[model samples]
Target: MNIIFEESPKEVADSATGFDLFQDRSIVAIKVNDELRDLSHKLSDGDTVIGVSIDSDEGLSILRHSAAHLMAQAVQEIFDPAKLGIGPPIKDGFYFDFDVEEPFKPEDLKKIEKRMKELVGKSQRFVRREVSDEEARELMKNEPYKLELIGLKSADVGEGAAEVGAGTLSVYENINPDGTIAWMDLCRGPHLPNSRTVGKSFSLLRSAAAYWRGNENNKQLQRIYGTAWPTQEQHDAHLERLEEAAKRDHRKLGVDLDLFSFPEEIGSGLAVFHPKGGVIRRVMEDYSRKRHEEAGYEFVYSPHITKSNLFEISGHLQWYSDGMFPPMKLDAEYADDGTLKRQGQDYYLKPMNCPFHILIFRSRQRSYRELPLRMFEFGSVYRYEKSGVLHGLTRVRGMTQDDAHLFVSNEQLESELTNVLDFVLGLLRDYGLNDFYLELSTRDPENPKFVGSDELWERATSTLESVASASGLQLVPDPGGAAFYGPKISVQARDAIGRTWQMSTIQLDLNLPERFDLEYVGSDGERHRPIMIHRALFGSIERFFGVLTEHYAGHFPPWLAPVQVVGVPIADEFGDYLQKFADELRSHGVRIEVDHSDNRMQKKIRDHTMAKVPFILLAGARDQEAGTVSFRYRDGSQENDISLADARIKILKAINDKTQV
Candidate 1:
């Protein structure tokens, strides 16, 4: 019989399965008729065959999934009667959850890894079996989570969704050479062919307590996370990257550098910046304001709360109500006889700044000369983020966004968007994030949430696509990821360790103007609707501060550093000289401090160095007499006995240039 295969057409000698179709060891699974299938899947004439290479995404997922089974088998060997939960492959790694007697310790991971190594060397075969629901219930009766998963197939469920989503239940058994089953687990798997295929490049990173199916209200299970690479070189690279990331973790550096803290008194997802952190934040905002002012932007301020009618007119009440805080009823009046005199109105904490900007645009009638009315604000918006998703600074409930909106005529949309892109990229480069690519989020035709005519949608999307492409950056498409009012182009930027973060966004809107009935008189003496372009450069000031903290590993650029210079006197006798220099620098708007404690000069240097000070100035008796100060850089290099004037020039140049020390 003839077959259409991915690489080449071929004929098989026997009535065969996918295993017979491709004998390459790297071919871990098969895609039969465009659907992923196990190696043991039976194939017939007229069927299409595509090999799943072990290094490809689908193949890696299969390998990791099979590795998860090996981990489960290992847990069964070392741990006493461990009950199975779900084992699935995640991005860059895999995890297996188990209902063990206790939380896994560091030693437990070592023991399980050792057993996994032994099992991988066994070259065990994975035998697949299909069973009726009754038989599956009987087989998994010992595992309550498995039975619960089985019941969830009809009622909607979680971890086991992968197990029963295909309309049937299947089990994979780790078979020994003697044809007896060593272990078994329920899965819908297109896993690696055998245990030997999962080589020695896998490592169980760590273990933690996780709620079953990620539901906090459910029972917590012990989950072990592990990563597998195609080669040892790749594994080592990943481990090195992990090390760098841990060193740059913003939360750790924040505390060590005395930047910011999340206090319980202020509630979860709310943070208070310390004096030092506030200094950095103020510098960031100051620079941003200067840049926007130079770019022809008008600064605007809006109240933190507004009547719900504004959101209702903007359609945010219909589209984004889920992310908005519940309303506050205010302004109700009562009579002395207990009869209601006036009705209360719903006032909501503003979750966005666009509606207020729209009001500003509509407040007065204007002509085409004011077409691109750029309005900027450091708008503080509140979001109702779930407690489970609250992260340090990056994900917060209260954030101040460097938000702006441009009201441009429809004819000026393209050039206005082009200029906005240029402005956004240039400003971000100032913050030291130079790596970027554009992600175009277009409307999903199948979804009704997006409100716009096809002509308007196509025009807006094409304008953004051309602008992004013209910027000479790669563009990735995100289908169905746009806001309800319009499509957007989000900038994805890479940090020092190559992890990408969504930094800024440029959204072209047509629906909101119509929803709010906004208009302006055009050159032809007729009323025409204006286009709205929403842009958020920092995404939020708090999130950007956190990213920069990690990007520089807390050694911020001199201009943005909280404490730019610290003076360390060799002894109490030299304090006056250093204090004079500190005062001079302070007069020049530099943040400088002179250490006059009884502690030795070396101790003061150590303290300032620990704070990540950009420059440490030293004044010893000899240097003070010679009218020079020693310059100790953050990296511990020193320039001995530099003249005071020359040292001031170099420090000022570094700060003015915004160069990293």
Candidate 2:
């Protein structure tokens, strides 16, 4: 029979399967007609097929999904009555949810892992079988969550889509070496060929409480998180990275360095910076302000709350109301008779700063001369983030966005976008994030949430694409990731440990201006709608702060360090001498401190080093007599007998150059 295999037409046996076509062991599954299918799937004439390598992203997901099924089987074997929920492969790992009689303990995870290893050793084959909806319901009658997923086959089941979607239901039977079905699950999968291929590279990390399908209103199930890799070496490397990531966790560093806190009394997702963190924030903001001013951005301010009518005009109320906090009804006046009262208006805490900037632009008529007017604000906006998703500074309810809005004529949109991209990259580089690529977030035509006509969206998307392409950076397409009103180019930055974070977003907006009736006079003396561009360089101060903290692992550069220098004396007699030197450094705008506590000099050095102080100055009677101080760095390297004049020059130069010491 004739078929297209890996994009080339070839002749194969009529009964050929994907497993028979791809001999490489690494090719775990096959994509038949663009749909992922098991290697055992029989090929039909004229069918197109491609192999999926075990190390590829799709292959890893399939491997992890198979591992998840293994884990679920193990769980059911040990914890008899454990009902299964969704098990999907995430970025670097997989998690399975279970409705168990009790929460899973660490010991339970160990037992589960042991059983999974035994199952892997048994070399069970994964066999897929298609079933009708009623048949699936009957098979999963004892499994309440599975039955629910079957019922939700035609609806949006969120993560449960991995199990049962709006298609034919299928069950994967884990068959033993003796050709008997050992365990099974209702899943739409392209899983690994056998349990042995899952190998010993998988691990169960931890377990926690999770809602079924991630809905807070649903019953909470126990979720066991795990990681799986094709090879042991890769698995080991991932575990090491996880350990390093834990050590660099910003939330922990926040407490250890006394930088910030999320006080429960103030509620979740709101952070209060300590004095040291405030100092760092101030320096960050000050430098950003200087850069914005140099880039011809006008600083503006707006109230925290605005009437709902403003957002309604900007289309935010209609499209983004879910993210917005509930409005406050205000300004109603009632009669003493408690009869009729004036109608009150709803005032919402601003979820974004663009609409306010739009109002600023609309406050006065403009001409072509002011075409590329830029407005910037360190605007504090509030979002009603769900409690389940509320994390540290990275995911907060209240944040200060380094937001900028540019109003330019349609002819200047591409140039302005290019300039904005350059400015964003340069500013982010100044803050120590140099590695970046651009992601183009275009509208999903099928999604009704996006505004604007097809012509406008195409123009804006193509314009932004041209600008991004001109920058000569790798551009990735994020289909359906755009805001409701516009398409955007988001800068993805890789940190020290090679983790990517979305740093800045430059959005080209055509709908908002039209919605708000914003217009400017052109050279032809006709009123023309100006295209609005939304840009956030830092995304948010709190989020960037957290990113920087983790990127540096709390060892901030000398310029951005909270306490740049600390002085330690070998003995009490030398205390005044070190203090005198600190005073001299402080006069030059350095953040310097002298340790005057009763602790030993070694303890002081250790304490300041742990605090990530860039420079620790030490003075002894001998050094004092020599008119020199000892230099101690965070890495515990030391240089003794450096003259005070030379030391001051070196310290000042590091801070001025923004160099890491």
Candidate 3:
């Protein structure tokens, strides 16, 4: 018999098992062919095997999922009324939901953790056994959630298909040394060998209320989150990263810095930027516009609402109607008898800017000379984001997109797309983001939602793939992830904390132009359809603002700071002198302010520093007499009594150069 291990094939005994070959304890599981199997799985003839180590991503998921089951057992032991729910592993951790009578508080989490520690210390063995639906229901009759799952399994729908559709249901039971059962749960699992393996390197994060299956209409249950790692050092590192992420959470920093707020009156997912936040947004938009103007993009404008026919022509009504808000029936008419005279038209808030841009292209005749025509707009779009998915700024319903559409001839498609990629990367670099990679989203063959012929899609997809590959950056394939009308190359950027954010997208659309009957006259004097390239560099202003806030940890560079320079007088007497200096800076188009509040000098400095001001200019006795101001940087570094001439030059140069301090 031929057995493959570590990518090498050799003859071995058919009776050989994963545990016999993979003697290293770090090898948690075995991949037989393409399927993950337990280490105790026996090897068959002509089998390809690979080791799954504990430190790998898949290994960590299994470890965390096993921890989730152990935690569920502990919850049941500590809380008599607890009922089991689905437990799934997520990025960096796992969470399990419970249908308890009351929510778990902070103190309750401590009790659960204590019980978990005791369970781990028991060194119990985990025994996996398969049972019929009737037997499983009878065994777990007391647990309503489990019984409901058994019923779902019988019907083979929802999560039940995964729970038992494999022809049988499996339950994992913790066994005592005396061959007695401790605890068990219904799950489709490839768990760690024992509860003891889910060791001390795990911590319960927090508990929150979540609707079952993510449907708000379903019953809400309490969910507990936890993370598992291979070592204590790794666990500590994960915790430290979580702390840093919390500190940089944009929602908290937004309020702490007086940036933005979500008003209840304005409704959920709608934001109102305060004066400070408005300044930051204005700076961002202005800089982007300047860059676009230099890049030869013609600025365009469109209305907020339009007749539903536009979306219908763009095929958005068929493929994307669910994401759009319901339409408003307008232009109603009535006769003297109060009977309907004429039917009304349905108008919808524009969920996208592409259809409108297409209308502009079709409004007039075009020659090949204008084939590479680019149209730009800061178009605000609205999406019906469910309340459960909406977050601060990042996931808002209303957002202005820094969108552009480029039309090019078929022969010029590849070159124009290459240029667009370069333009996207360069503009993003100007915004202080350098780390990036490209994801090529292509059409799914099985889904009929994608419009256009295979030939058109292939040409569009290959052109984008070639352009993205030629950029010499990593390209990840996203199967079945393309827009219904075209394929897109989305730019994935890494933030300061090593988190990736979808910053920009450049899509190659061939269907919309054809659907809209957009054309240009070629040198051959023949009318030919143009290829439309849709690009959104910022994705949305609200989301970009959130990303920037968290990326910079609310300490924006001098160029983008809401208040570039703040004038702080050491004494009340020097207020006049500081105000004069602030006037000079303000005249230079700098965002400057003089603190005239009744707070003490140190208190004023503290207040401005907490606001994350880039520069704090202090004027005192000798400095005011010397006609110089002291410079205080965000990092608490200082330069005293710099000449006014040099100070202006230094500050102006930093702002112009976009320096971070």
lDDT winner among the candidates? 2
Query: Candidate 3 lDDT, tens digit per residue, 86-139?
Result: 787788888888999999999888888888888889877776678988889878
* Cα-based lDDT for every prediction: 0.89, 0.93, 0.87
Write down the worst ten-residue block by lDDT for model 1.
154-163
Worst 10 residues of 3 by lDDT: 156-165
Worst 10 residues of 2 by lDDT: 153-162
List residue ranges in candidate 3 displaced over 4 A: 1-53, 76-86, 97-111, 127-172, 184-190, 207-223, 231-233, 341-345, 596-598, 625-627
lDDT of 1: 0.89
lDDT of model 3, residue 80: 76
Q: Candidate 1: where is the Cα deviation over 4 Å?
A: 1-63, 75-86, 97-114, 127-173, 184-193, 197-201, 205-224, 230-240
Better of 1 and 2 by TM-score: 2
Provide the clashing-pair count of each candidate structure.
Answer: 0, 0, 0
Residue ranges of candidate 2 with Cα displaced over 4 Å? 1-59, 80-86, 98-107, 127-172, 186-193, 208-222, 230-236, 341-346
Model 3 TM-score is: 0.86
Local distance difference test, candidate 2: 0.93
CA lDDT, candidate 2, residue 361 = 92
The per-residue C-alpha lDDT of model 1 at residue 207 equals 96
What ranking emerges by lDDT with the best candidate at the front? 2, 1, 3
Candidates 1 and 3 compared: the better one by lDDT is 1
